[model samples]
Target: MPPKSAHHALQLEHERERDATQGFEPKGTFGFIRYLEHGFPSSLVRWHYHDEYELHLTLESSGKVFVGDYIGQFAPGHLVLTGPRVPHNWVSIDTPEEGVELRDMVIQFAHAPLETLAGVIPEVKSILPLLHRALHGIEFFNISAQAHERFMRIRDSTGLPRFIEFLTLLGELARSSDYQLLSTIPMQSTDDDAALARISSAINFIVQNYASQFSMKELAQQLDMPERMFSRFFRSATGNSFTDFVNRLRVNKACELLMETERYVTNICYDAGFNNVANFNRRFLELKGMTPKAFRQQAQGRFGA
Candidate 1:
């Protein structure tokens, strides 16, 4: 498994509701794609996931990048494409006294429209392989400048021109070999929509409440599912047992604190929902391959702190 999965459930729920009520894609939009940009420390900067494939470009600042179970550093021009419902966030560690003006530029689009197009458009089908690979998130290298330029074109245009630029960019990315898959365990879901919805709800709950104690029994009850059945369903959907998933989320939380704060290891352990220092140390090492203190020391070097 990758180190951890991260999300903010309340914010994710809010985004879902907002999109449902107000709509994210424009009424007159020709394609499913939407372009968005936000600065550091903004409301958009949260650990959350949505039902769109996102091409994320870091325009300013460097810090921790969380994609599904993967945790690592990101600087300017760092580009990643994440699939639908993959929890992700980027926290800036080296912000100035005055925060950055524009920290991230993103393009989000749905999978269905493109898949539908590919039925008749042979060339459009080439990107499907790349889309499949993005189920685990892809970090692209050596093409940041081209990505930035193409993103600008896609953002500034509308209708067919924008769609053309979007395909052009995806084609470039699809053809490029300089990329790495971030998540070790791919997030594959069963065809049952109800089961997927339940899993999504459960994941949101875990993201919001990972700092506190919770039980699979309670969650299963809330979802009106049998404990054993839910256990099988969850592991099938997320590639980890319920308890293991939550623990990894907590470990990822610990990683964030270690990289971004000066709190003591014991305090961070508890803050990350670990009950005791010894267990925290062990789990941290098991997932991150380092003790908490050592992790913090190395993370600090990222900021020269």
Candidate 2:
């Protein structure tokens, strides 16, 4: 058998591989709340989802923020609230500085604790609507410099002080009117068990096998339902047709690859499960409002690639 160090290294490698393939992971400390500070070009900067609700403040950077299917610009003083299990990432524009540190301040907490507290203190429920809006992710705009200072204070404090500061921040955000919903579609959650199960299965299958050619008939059969019935149910549950959902996933993957790699557009289209270039270009333009080449160029210009 290998040494203990070798075994630990192997375990770390396996965990990383799992994270690369399966995007969902638990983040931060396993407590009521967790605080994290990160610099640019860190390993934590990636496209991944977590079960915690994240209150993120940009400290020193300007770049694009991707939440679910929405992508937009972000800069210093940009604040966002992301709900549980929403895929999100922030890519900073490249800078000339060699060793910049601490570009973001992040706070994450579980929903259950807040919900429990709200049950006891009704006043806390005022933020419930804001939490609901975070299901699609919320970007707070025109945030004042004082609000940014509060975020820094939250990061600097500990224990109950940190918790109180966080609650105060939430109260202010809940009352503020300057914000935008980033995602067009909300992450579906339903009380109907059957509908939830069916939709979850369908989404998981697509995420796991997005590179393959999707057949609606085959998917319906796999779900043990007729094609027409499955189509209706999918639309009702997701607010998107089966074809549109698949196309959006493919387009999203294409966008990631376009920004992250130097692959040819045609090759990226095929790799993203599109059969041909023309359809890919058409769908890309329709979804992203730009050609793949133009998108890449724009991203390159922003990142100084």
Model 1 scores what on Cα lDDT?
A: 0.81
Tens digit of per-residue lDDT, candidate 1, span 1-305: 11123334313423444341232344355356787777777767776677789999999999988787676789999999999877688989999988988888888889999999999999999999999989899999999999999989988889888999999999999999999998767664444556656776787677668888778998898888899999998888778889888878899888888887888888999999989889888888898798888888887887798
For candidate 2, write residues 1-305 as lDDT tens digits: 11122211111112234342222224432246666677787666765566778888888878878776566667788889998877678888864466348787777778988999999999999988989999899998777576777777776676788788888988998998998898778753445546645666676577658889869888898888999999998887767889988888889889988998999999999999999899999999999899999999999999998
Scored against the true structure, residue 94 in model 1 reaches a CA lDDT of 96
After TM-score superposition, the amount by which residue 187's alpha carbon in candidate 2 deviates from its true location, in angstroms, is: 2.8
Off by over 4 Å in 1: 1-52, 58-78, 84-129, 141-145, 157-164, 171-183, 188-193
| Superposed model 2: Cα runs more than 4 Å off | 1-80, 83-132, 139-164, 171-182
Collision pairs in model 1: none
TM-score of each: 0.66, 0.58
